[model samples]
Target: MNSEFSYRLLPGLLPYYAFRVCTKFLQSQDLILPGVIIGFLANGFNIFSNWLFIFQFELGVNGAPWATSLTRAIQFIFMILYLLWRKDSLADTWPSFSLRKLSYNVVKPFLTLAFSGMFSFAAEAWSFEVTTILAGLLGTIALDSHTITLNIATFIYLSFPFAVGIATSIKVGQLIGEGKAADARRSAIVAYGVNFAVQITLIAIVWPCSRLIASLFSKDEEIVDLVASLIPLSCIFMLGDAVQANTGGALRGLGRQKLVLLLNILGFWLLAVPFGAVLAFATNIGVRGLWWGFTVGLYSAAFIGILFLVFRVNWEKEAFKAQRRIAQTSQ
Candidate 1:
């Protein structure tokens, strides 16, 4: 088994994983910063609250797990309270206690979320997962270097998606709400522009310091060697990453979850994973092969995601009209 298996698994990991997944809901609704503070504080509180278990019983590393769980629980609780208090922002527009309403309110949003939010995460995660697997097959130093590059790329990527989500969520929601087709189109363009500007700035900052950042993860000569060789690829990878995420956000705003899901599966599973596996194991391409796969898949997803957004405009309008008809019938 992998060294990190227990890190991703274990009963204690669930709450934190759930918090990460559910936080997107808050983000799409514009509550992330406050939620993060509450989450961090909750974690701090959990450590304090569970200090008795650590000190009195000496549970060792296990006590840390309990502390993490307590944090997630408290974070979830706070989020629930916040949502309930801000009922207008969080509530379903039409109310009913029936199963049908539940399906519409919770199930649909969740299904959309699974594809748009979770599936996208899965695509990105699998890219890293496969990298880890491939690196393991190669050697430990290769694995260390791969992990280093992946972490830096991830940190750099965190900026674009949140900004993209802001534009996509608010503008698309408003456009759909008011039947403004031109505005919907403009919003997508605007999101892309914003993502482009921000991502370019990040690339400029990191590209020159790429080796410096990579060196931070490890001091081993072999690991550092691998990282230095991969820095350029990592920079390219970041651009593709930005495009993929922001385009996915645009689709999410357009409510095209199925399309987004299909695009991700095709891009990552069909194209990236298989090719990377072949090059990483069957050939002598090494760690860079894994990143090459990442670049290909991300670029493919970005292109396809953009195409999906373009085609989805009419469908989005139709969805709005259909909802309007339902409302008219009820009236």
Candidate 2:
């Protein structure tokens, strides 16, 4: 499974990158619904392919990534087709390519921001990936619980808070572009209102029906028991995640990815992963140790993040800087 998971992940990387690029471009254009619909189609196909390859074909572990790769490829193709269909609408942004446009001065700032944003996301993501690896080391039962809980948390993050974050970033960017820093600040507040709304809704679903939720993922009684035990921790983890996502989104709108990268490193690496590893390996607390460690780090980071947004950030100044940068770039 190790070798298979490793190599299998490779085939999907390029397609996933392509899909992400297309989706982001669409998002920036305020064409999010297209990407969402395409994503749904791809995921729907992925589920069917997983069933076909894993169950009907009886290929087991080997079949899963193949299904994923195919789905990713389909998604990229669909996104490309969507762009082609909208060629006329995108023409202004897709001016003819020119060799003289490829200067370092033009690309450097973009690359810096892009890379900072990339690493900011990767830092948090990799911590969970690390947890998954550690779970594998603990044994099959532990891995099962970790996998199910992680998936549930990820699903909720992506479906709700993450979406709110993206919308907040877009709204803030629009407000800043219009030189309305006060409006952007208000938009951020509105986003938090939405974020907590969804979080409450999520807690309602995950708390009382935890065992039922676990059973949805796995039928084995032992796995169900273990996953249910992790749900309370996951609920707490989601709150921190929601706050982090909200703060992170606002910073991105301010073009402050460097600060975001710093925070993620301080939280996930300096705090979460190391502490979780110690709790998991140095103690008898087992998988829950890692879970608690992550919760602590996330909550700590989120607290600091919210504080920074409230006290440190100067929205009017950020908007002025952004307008200056835009004016300079246009020249």
Candidate 3:
């Protein structure tokens, strides 16, 4: 009952959620540096709030949600104040809302994009969560090693290709808005090429230093060995992961969002999870089998995405679609 009540505090975070959407919209409009700065500050505030509530206040486990809600509320207020100070059109226009304008211009497209994008994100995330659950079922050592390895991989992902992918999405969309279909395609190609080169270099660096990296996270020899063994598989997984991530971003910019969402559903849910389950339980390979399944799904998604970009996409048509969408919403 206490936990449920604590969880109820999540509703207080709606403002932060709105703020994030606003930030992303700004970033999509090419205001990248401001958005990045604000996001960094917000994250720092969240961390500080967590430390204050959990350590200084001695609030225990429930401190986490309180810290999150408080930090979000503060961040939301900060964003609103900044917008007001700038006399931003978004703030100025908020009071002039009308049902007819919203229905035709915002709500229709918003719902269509939101549902598809939400499912795509959820499908990929849930597959990894399920993989974690399966790892826990393997044993304590397996779960610990898996957790540490996953953390390292996630850190690397967020550091480079993910950032590049987001920038690529925004840039592509901007180019499309200008009706430069060829330039948009070129941008995507360059983004994908750069991501590939960077990922390959990192893989080479990681392969030689796998044991050294694993040692940083664990003092246990068995855990270190397990993590080291997983690094090679992680390299393969990272390559596919980076490719699919970049491609998915490009697809979003091209306005083929429904297709992107479908691909994620097919790749992660229909393919990765069941295959990983079979390999983990039916074979003697254990936890590594789960990661192997992950590699397969990512590779499949990347291949399909790349193929679509190369052979199937009509850049001219996509540019026009982007133009129409932008024009509609701006009104």
Candidate 4:
């Protein structure tokens, strides 16, 4: 079983890498609609493929991940088709493939941003992986419940907030590069508003349909019940996730990813995980306690990003710095 799982994982990464390449290119170009359309299409394809593989072919247990991998590959393929059909947009950017002059002076700043961005994102993601480990300590049922609830939350998150955050990043960077500080700040506000509204709508749906939602993932009564119970907590955490995603987008645009990095580590590791460990082991709260702890981390961690963007930042000064970066990069 272990060897089979590992083998399947190898195939999974290929589609994931392809999806990343296409979506990242689209986002970098500020072409939000193409990426969003591709995402919805991929998810729809995933559903169809899963049904085909699992029930139609009797592939059973391994069908879902395989379906997912196929969908990811399809997404990139669809993207390539879109680019080919819409020759004008790609043509504008791909007029020629050229990597302008390279130097340590030119490369160092980008390397700094890349490392900081990578670590900041990795820390939060790894912290969540630790929660999965902690849930396993409670036994199979708890782990199953945690996995289902997380999958649901992730689906909702990626559906909207993720896209909004990317748009926020691209828009802010563009406005700042143009030396329009106030407009960049306004763009940040609009992004926050959109994310907040979308998340609230999702929470309202999830809170009432918790059981129905849980049933979609599993049939076992215990797992379904546990997931329903966890769904509310997931909604609570969703609040934090929305805030963090939105503000983090702006921070990434601002090039303050190191600050984002420190806050996530402190919030998730120091505050959330420890609190959850104590609650889960010391009290009768059990697996739900772990989620409560994550909730704390999400809200607390996101607040710092808010503070930096709202209270601390000088908009005009930021614009000047962005202009300077642009000038340097262009040179």
Candidate 5:
């Protein structure tokens, strides 16, 4: 329901939006459009490759993941090559494998990302695992229904985070490079706004035809019924999902990934999963109780991500300064 939901929209688009705002600030549009075009192609390359793998291989559900991973590797290689060739665009982008510098700059960030990503992965993985286990306890029918609804929900979950990744990578990278604190704040705002608008629009479009969406994953009538019943909750889950994913990405851009990881750990491990266990196993809410636990966890992480960002302003400045000092010292 929030407006200007940029973060939940598309990560690729955020760079373009940031460029537009940044160019306006500098009164230059000539390079902005071209840069955005290149960025679009850059993003589209992997997407196109993914489609080719899927369509060509008939990879269906599982094929998509492999295709995506392969395409991402290709994309990474392409970006590396492009950056190498276009050295001017990447001002000192490469890093030396020095222990001292690595310890100070890259190691903590990498570990933070590892933990944060694991926690993020855990949020859903824990719920899905719980659902499967509980479903087994309930009977094959309940398990099938749970699986059907979850697969559909999983597809839906992919959209918001992709958008968030792009927004954070672009906006944060630009702000750090140009030292635009005010615009960095605006970038976060714009991301949240665009994300809200896009997601709400998506929900409206998807809500009326929830059954149709559910049917894509399975053909079982009873499962379809369960899926239909759960569509509203799935939509609700995505709202919190939007907040957690994009906000996490924003924090990453601001170099507070460690805090995000910690929040994720506490939100999912200590709070959401435990609450879900109590609700699903100990209460009468049935499988729906499990989902409620997932929802609670997502909302909790989202709230923590926002709070983390709010308190991270000075930290962002300091991170940039530290990076600059390192770069200067290296020179």
Candidate 6:
């Protein structure tokens, strides 16, 4: 509850939220290196604060959440200061005078985007959490294997295509905002190509090093063996995962927030969870079945996302929508 409250309090920092979008906008404008530096600094502050509170103050586990809250607060302050310092880039977009003007135009579209985007991400996260719970039901060894494999997979994901997705999202959105629909489409295509190449390369590395990687996490032969087997499956999963993630990013860029939200729900909750549950319980495959179900769902989402991007999207219309949204919101 305390953690939840701290997270809830983040939206209260209006300027921070604005600056986050502004930073993404800036990235789209080809000013990405600075944003990356700032992001690194922010992450460093988060880690440093955690260390300070946990060790220096001897707060133990409680220190971690407090550190998170503190880091976000500091980030909010830093972003606001940065915006003020670089007023030229943000001055036109920044709201002034009546709060009503900002609320109706800017805040409305933002809320629309935020709510849908939040739901879309939440659906994916919740599906994974549900899978974890199901893994626990399998037995201690199964759950441990699942935990270790998931942690490693998540780490690899954060290290690679995840960043590409974010960068692509910003690039595509910015291009749309500027009415460069063709460029936005081209950016999405390039993002997909890059995601596939990187994921495939990582898959090769992971496949050969699976046992070694698993051993680093655990000394137990049984646990390590279980994790090693799962790694190959996870590599396969990454193919679909990379595609879905980047495609989702592209959809977000196109302001198809509601569509993305619907797709996530259909893919994860409607398809993945049920299929995984069935495979886990009704079949002899046990934990592996669960992962297979997850793979199927991911591929399902990836296929749908790719199809939408290639066949259904109207780039010009999306660009117009982005323009209207920003125009209506800005002072």
Models 1 onward score TM values of: 0.78, 0.89, 0.90, 0.86, 0.69, 0.86
lDDT of model 5, residue 273: 70
Give every collision pair in model 2: none
User: Per-residue alpha-carbon lDDT of model 1 for 16-85, expressed as tens digits?
Assistant: 6666655656665556676668766886797685785567668655566556666677777676676667
Sort order, lDDT high to low: 2, 4, 3, 6, 1, 5
- Estimate, for each residue in 1-331, the C-alpha lDDT of model 5 and write its tens digit: 2332333333334344444444332222123444444446656875776677668777554444454455444444444454456567545544346667665454555576567666765664665685678767866766777787677666766766555655664576467656676777777777887787777887787778888977876788877777777777778877777777678767766656566767776767777677766886798766677677778887988887787678646745745764684475455
Top of the candidates by TM-score: 3
lDDT of 6 by residue, 236-297 (tens): 88888888889888998888888889888888888888898899889987777778887898
Pairs that collide in candidate 3 are none
For residues 1-331, could you state the per-residue lDDT of candidate 3 as single tens digits? Answer: 5875468478556977888876786676676666567668878988998899889999876777888888778777777776666666555344365676666667778788778888888888888899999999999999998888888888879888888888788888889889999999999999999999999999999988999999999999999999999988988899888898899899888766788898998788878888888898899988998888888888898899999999998899888988888788877
lDDT of 1 at 273: 79
Flag the better candidate by lDDT, 2 or 6: 2
The runs of at least 3 residues in candidate 2 whose Cα sits more than 4 Å from the true structure, single-residue gaps closed, are 5-12, 48-61, 136-139, 218-222, 281-284
Model 2 TM-score (2 dp)? 0.89
RMSD list, candidates in order: 4.2, 2.5, 2.7, 2.9, 9.3, 3.4
Better of 3 and 5 by lDDT: 3
Clash totals for all models, in order? 0, 0, 0, 0, 17, 0
Error of 1 at 281 (Å): 3.9
Ranking by TM-score: 3, 2, 6, 4, 1, 5
lDDT per residue for candidate 2 within 1-331, as digits (tens), equals 7897678868888989988987877777678899889988998999999999899999898889888988988889998898899999998775456655566665777899999999999998998999999988999999999999999999999989998998888888778877899999999999998899889898987889999999998999989999999998899889988988898898898888998899899888888888888998899977887888889888888888889889998989988988887766555
- Report the Cα lDDT for residue 257, model 3: 77
lDDT of the candidates, in the order given:
0.70, 0.88, 0.84, 0.85, 0.65, 0.83
| Cα RMSD, model 2 | 2.5
lDDT of 4: 0.85
Q: For residue 289, what is the lDDT in candidate 2?
A: 79
Q: Residue 148, candidate 1: how far off, in angstroms?
A: 1.6
